[model samples]
Target: MTRHARSERLLLCDELDRLGPDRPTLCEGWQTRDLAAHLLVRENRPDLSVGRFVPFLGGHLDREQRRIANGDYAAVVDRVRRGAPAWNPMSNAKVDEITNLIEFFVHHEDVRRAQAGWAPRELAPQLEGKLWSALRRSARLMFRKAPTGIVLIADGRGRYAAKLPDAHGTVVLRAPVGELVLYAYGRKGVARVGFEGDADDIAALQGAELGIS
Candidate 1:
């Protein structure tokens, strides 16, 4: 579970190369190649903060959408690889590297899920826990002043959601952890996930909290 900075980069490149242009990704309007390009850009640019990253991300997203439209992911890959730079967003190489890991991990699975492919066998368990907390803790200000009884669960990582508000029994969801990460980002909903109970409600709750809906 001890994730290092360099390993995350290797994972990104490996996954992207492995995915290639023949696959589809979970990021809605993106093909495997397009998604790879988008991620390449993000990983390289970790110098920007969340706010700055948004604008930069928007441009890549626009390009990505076009790549998918043309169904020519190969071109997109070429464009990015030609003269692209790595602009770490977090301002902390070590910190941003972990963040980068989260990004690559989630997006990689996003693409795989869209194509019904399998997850990478080498995914790090250490990251699995942090990602869940990052998502739940992210909603701290947006949700209640403090966490109620909500027991936000993502397996080994007992992340935020300390405020359950009287909900009994953990709202268990048996989904690919990667999909769960995207869900946290408001990139998808329950329909796109494997679930147990009240899928609609979970989606609604997640959407409302994350502002996806």
Candidate 2:
């Protein structure tokens, strides 16, 4: 089986190199260099990455991220390209795939969509299936805070009830799996997904804070 996580990592690295460090990315306030440093911290520094979920440690994570971002830009990008080191749990192929697939895919789009003249890429069906499978496993938790019912349709893949019906009813989002993933990841402004349902419900879903932090 092909490993899309690895491929996305390399592609993101190439974009980082081509665009140089100062390029903008869809991650608000994060440039290419910062994004690269983020990937490195996520893969290599489990101790600090906890700050991503534990709010109190955020300052430490932020300081380390800035330190890495301020260093050699080329070196930072190269480290991301090289992926997690032997000591990092993400170094295992299966673990990396299970964890980094969506992480890299979202971040890759984060970098691409923030640029000028960028377009969504056509993804392989296998990769789309993998993403859909992953979505199926996590949609509820990801959409738990949605103020309205949520449904995601991945064209040929299938439909998923991302959130249970709420008083506002359900809103459906239609897109290719990759785009749906982007939308679910809270790249709402950049994600090329179409919405349908009662206008109010759709609006509520749109305004709702989404994605895991």
Candidate 3:
């Protein structure tokens, strides 16, 4: 049902290889090499993965990630292409599909959209549906601090209330499902979604910090 996860992972690895280690990505300060190393740590070092969500261990994670990124860039990409190692729970096909589908797709776009002249890819209907479902599951957390009410609207894909209305009211973000996913992931600088609502509320939403770390 979620085979797109594997395809997206492979595609991201290909782009990492093609673009080389120094290319920029939409991930704040992370270059391609840094992103690849983060992926490796995410899948292979469960101990370090906690650092991503735990403020105290952030330094340790950063140090370890830098250690990995400083190595042979080609070797890093090759390891990512091989997928999670057998010892990692992510190596289980079902677990990988459930967890990595959104992770890989968003990171793929992180690399793609950072490049000049890049445009959104037309995702298959099945992939779109899966992304929409994933968004539904995580929308509230992603939009938790949004200044206004939040609704995501994708034509022919239905709408979801990511956050209920605040005093300023709701803002509707209209775009393809994939774009919505990107926006929810803090790729606001590159996501092509449009907004509908009170001008002030929309503006407030635009300025608000959105997405998970």
Candidate 4:
């Protein structure tokens, strides 16, 4: 697990290095270096005092996200927020670790796909569990939109299987574990995955409303 985290950080660092200082990235309006700076800030800023980190009241993170999603990522954020020496900073939020893990994992792909147009990076084997847990949960969240369930079959080398929580049938997706994992998160296109169940549901997951395309 530790190694996976370290490897993940290294991969992101490599992508950032490759992007250099003046290239536009997949993330809108933010340059590649700008994304790197944002990541560095997120990882390093975990040590701030409560007052500095969490705001008491306002529009909330959702509102903040809306503002930033269509606004300037660089203008509002400081690129290099220094953090205490703890390797990586963490949050006290209930789901902080899991949420950040997914954020980093998906965005790592986002950064790579957006800028270099490269294949997904190789992830640690342990990531299979975290990925399964995450995708399973996210599947439930996305289930309401579909009449059936989707079964995601990874390389099966990892602990994950072509799991379908509750549905009429199963849909199978197989590839290199890393690529399959990304595909399950709806990070990769539906065509990249081999489907084995309801075509409509599969198409829904791959639909424009879901935003994987």
In order, candidate lDDTs are 0.49, 0.90, 0.91, 0.50
Q: Distance from true position, residue 155, model 3, in Å?
A: 2.4
Q: What is the C-alpha RMSD, rounded to one decimal, of candidate 2?
A: 1.1
By the TM-score metric, which is better: model 2 or model 3? 2
lDDT of 1 by residue, 67-167 (tens): 44356555555443332344434445556654555555555456555655353443466666555555565544334422123334455555344344434
Instruction: Give the TM-score ranking, best first.
Output: 2, 3, 4, 1
RMSD of every candidate to native, in Å, equals 6.2, 1.1, 1.2, 6.7
Off by over 4 Å in 4: 40-99, 120-124, 127-130, 142-147, 157-170, 211-213
Which candidate ranks first by TM-score, i.e. highest?
A: 2
Off by over 4 Å in 3: none
Q: Residue 87 lDDT in model 2?
A: 88
Clash count, predicted structure 1: 21
Task: Give each model a TM-score.
Answer: 0.57, 0.96, 0.96, 0.57
List, residue by residue over 100-205, the lDDT tens digit for candidate 3: 9999999999999999999899989999988898899999999998989998998679999888888689899999999999988888888899998999998888
Task: Tell me the tens digit of each residue's lDDT in model 4 across 18-120.
Answer: 5555666555666655565555445553332232346763235334334343444343223222221344434333344455556566656766776544665
Worst lDDT run of 10 residues, candidate 1, spans 141-150
Q: lDDT by residue for model 2 over 13-75, one digit each (tens)? A: 998999999989988899998999998888888899999889999999999999999999999
lDDT winner, 1 or 2: 2
